[model samples]
Target: MSFASLLPAAVLFALSFRLAGAISAQTFAPPSKGPLVQTANYTSFSNNTLHNKHVVKGKVFDRIIQVWFENTDFATAISTPAFEQLTKQGLLLTNYNAVTHPSQPNYVSAIGGDFFGLQDDAMFHIPSNISTVVDLLEEKHISWATYQENMPENGYYGISYKAANYGNSSAKPYSYYVRKHNPLMVYDAVSQDPARLRNIRTFNDFANDVVNGTLPQWVFVTPNMVNDGHDTTIDYAASFLEYWLVPLLTDKRVNGDRTLILVTFDENETWEIQNNVFALALGGAVAKHLHGTTDDTLYTHYSSLSTVQANWCLGSLGRQDTNATVSNVFSFVAQKTGYKNVHVPANQAPQFNLSDVAPGPLNSDAYIPFAAPNLKARGAGGGPVFLRPGLNKTLTVEKLPPPVDLYSLKKAVPWQMSPRTTSGKNIIPCADSDCK
Candidate 1:
């Protein structure tokens, strides 16, 4: 059915949805729900007509920055004073959601457009032949880069940094540059390609680029564990952004009317939380009047790709992104309005990063990062269990034993497969170790 046909119901429903607004940042409610502290309030906009309007033209934003944070639910994040204060400076998507649980698959889905049944944080490779948003950006001649904090070196391809200071790996104060949160590293094309490999740099590079006005057209930034609120609280991540990133948004070289910045988390606190995360859309590209407004559209991680694809008309990754919804708040941009269809090819399923690549240059250990968790998709087994103790019940990835007698939580079972192979078939951690 056409979106036009669905408008009346959606608008009426939006009227009853909670609306987020820019009130006095100094006065706010106490935190609730998760690790740190989070959006509801959608229909309270002073300008009620905005609900009826789909697109509004304004400045075009060619430069975009995406900052991804760790697991934090909306309720908890909203309680965070800084995150709440920051919401006033831009459009808040109250109903936004992450694509999946655990950090790896969501990050993968953000760039690759599909999850491919990823259930753990293991190191894995995507084939060089398969394309990502990186390919689309490059195809359109748009420059892009991925900057991560605390990485050992530029293009360093490891699952995580050795503890920031040895014992700092403790869950509450977790701190490190984990590869699982950095999506670009898993792309075989970027990792194996020399020139593209260098594009994945540390946050220091991002700092320098911002100072030098050398930021790329599309930039992906990830903070360390503590800074992203993974092993810490939302207050930690919010303070990091408030102090480090907020200033950059004012510098014309780093941000302005022609640029867009998104501060979003990878997933939610628990599966019972339904994968909701706090999301903010701000920048020169965002209409000024939209600063304190809220968009209630139910967007997911794929919307990240969809927004960029729509903004640049970059086509699609031939996956769910081809059909994923774009950020409706930015409907004002002319480029976003001009195109709708996302180009797709028939063979769009994820081709493992190790597909067809020789082990000589690429090994299973480095290419495939996480071990199978045998997590059940259903309540008894495979499905997510959000009602757990501690702050990061799901995102704190586990380390399974190696192939030589790998672990079986319930009973002994054997499963193995090469990560960097074209066939890419292996032992998936089924509920009963049922690989079939």
Candidate 2:
């Protein structure tokens, strides 16, 4: 099909001349221009020099790493309470990346373990063969759902801005909750099953479900873009969390004894190649301020999913989860009332004298700099590494997955438009221009 053919059908679908006039005549201001924030600690997070020397040894130990992000960190400041939360509780992956740019693909990687060469919100449906961690949970009959804003029970639109009729809210208030937050459900093999699809609940319905003790085994929460801190402001997102999560945190059913909450960004906003995003772990399981210990391994979305899958005994999602080498970031050892006996291994405490290590504070905005190794060093599987003994004796340490030759996948189907909001009707037209 010619590119022109793909223009959204809104023009043709308008019911009348007046309706078209009402819709198309409305001119909207472009997204407000603002400085993109770099990582809060750019020097450390973006330091490719440090990333290149990285290797995974299971010895680093495992603990829950929940993350929350502000706008893309051009400033490189990791002073946020969320950053401190991850540092105190578990290992901070300073060199982590979302792999692909923009938003959707990164979320895809986080859930499905592969980017699949998507860069646009085409609403195109592609089969992700690799099972998601959700798949693992489902196989074991574990329940989970994406408590999405504006999404009805059956909403399936890929990505769009029409809040009333699109996948989520049009106010951009909850786009993050719908797009980046629901990766586990959107791209997983479980989504293919009607039973699983039925599990995806809308944002409005989530509170009552949790209150009634109907909380799923795993829960993915996404706030609107306006509130998610992904768009222009975090005030709404913070308010949303403070409003909902505070109660959930104290809930006997949801946060009772085993619940874990992770907050992380979809990707760095700068589109930089370094650690653009940070993760925060909180709940009964998280240790306090895990501060300076770095999990020095090549990581991205797949690695995150791989860790989740491994922890849940869910099999790998083919090549999507490249760095299943690391252990689960969540730990149950410290939970006050949430998951009990979840089997998080003890942290392998190693005292490394940091007096010898450079100590000036590295703002989260600094980028980790590194050029790629010679072509031979590049491949699908990442480079070889030593496993951390008992923590991951079963994993085979070999060359990592080959680098994706984007040129080769140019013809591949781009990411699709998120399905329509399922409030019993498709209330709005797709925001083709804005969404892309």
Candidate 3:
């Protein structure tokens, strides 16, 4: 549906008012102190931890901050008053899309380049051998971190955390922090590392990081389930952004110094339709002339990885990041970096609504073992491709044989035990419940 058709007259009036006088940074107070706050008697791990902060200059933007919301269709989000208002402050990406359904896979693909056939929101532990954008950033000595709101502790491994005395007493405790929404925690390479885990901090850590001028180069921020709209509405998510992000946009510590902030959703709400989610680029990196402009370039979750790779001239994971059909660098970044993006007609674009459609090592029913990346494939970054050790160099994902029917044979896949098996049941402790 057209944005104009979806936008109500009342919302349009509000948008006009918002554009006339944009919300001020002083309109809302700073984020509240959470469980990670440090007091004279109590010290949190995040407070004592020293986060890595190397300022690696990029071709377009020095820093990138990704703030992900929950499921909301493009039209639905754009029709909202706050979203429409916010669009006037930055460039709107009209053709941005999510890779697959549910949410975890999209989050995983955002950093790892490929989801490895993840189809559910179940707790998964990707093997350490698989390299992510984290590896690429670290290879160039570029610091990165993920700030998850309502996460009880730093580098927390619990499946979920519920706030005490939340909501009605008759109902179960409100699960504010969930593992599925956290992308870095799903990968064993990041979660198992003591240093990397410490970097996976809470919202309180975010406030502290900003206060101390210790924010990293790359940041992934996930609000709680309610604030992200997973358990609430888009209106609630917008309210949270108004309360939190609107103030931070003008803050020198968070959004200044050529920082590129992307406000986007994980996926669309309607599964039958294309996974087109509303996304916008804001911050000091956005040129003054580009404000309130719209870029209709087709982009996917993989584009997040590709854009970062192109901006920093980093090596490619050689997965979907090299796939021209799906991965396209942000137009502004591509223009500056001299990266050519493929423009597929909207009709020819891949339908990303289906889940478990692709076969990979992670899918037990139609399973194919892990294969080496296409070393010859060049990406927007125009750098050498990163190859994980122990991968079969002789086999490429394209050249791999037909998937084996492991489920029929009652065989378990390598890496970790299959989630269907009893052994894998204990992989995620206190899953979908209040651990503490």
Residue 412 of model 1, lDDT score: 22
State which candidate has the highest lDDT: 3
Per-candidate local distance difference test: 0.57, 0.40, 0.79
User: Model 3: per-residue lDDT, tens digit, 288-360?
Assistant: 8998889989999899899999999999988899999899999999999998999989889999988756788
After superposition, the stretches of candidate 3 with alpha carbons farther than 4 Å from their true spots are 1-3, 6-45, 49-53, 165-172, 407-436
Q: Candidate 1 — worst ten consecutive residues by lDDT sum?
A: 39-48
Q: Number of clashing residue pairs in every model? A: 35, 104, 0
Per-residue C-alpha lDDT of model 1 across residues 187-208, encoded as one tens digit per residue: 7768888878878876555555
TM-score, candidate number 2 = 0.55
Which scores greater on lDDT, model 2 or model 3? Answer: 3
Worst 10 residues of 3 by lDDT: 34-43
RMSD of each: 16.1, 18.2, 6.4
Pitting candidate 2 against candidate 3, the one with the higher TM-score is 3
TM-score of each: 0.64, 0.55, 0.86
User: Candidate 2's residue-wise lDDT over 1-436, tens digit each?
Assistant: 3212433465224223322342221122212121111121111111110011121212111222233344444123233333443355444554444554545556665655454444433344434433455655445455556655444334354553334312232534323334444564555355667656655555445544544445565666665555455544333334444444554555455553344466666666443234335554456543445434544343445545544444444444454353333222233221321212222222531211111121111101111111111223211222221111122222222423323332233322232334322122222344444442
**Candidate 2 or 1, higher lDDT:** 1
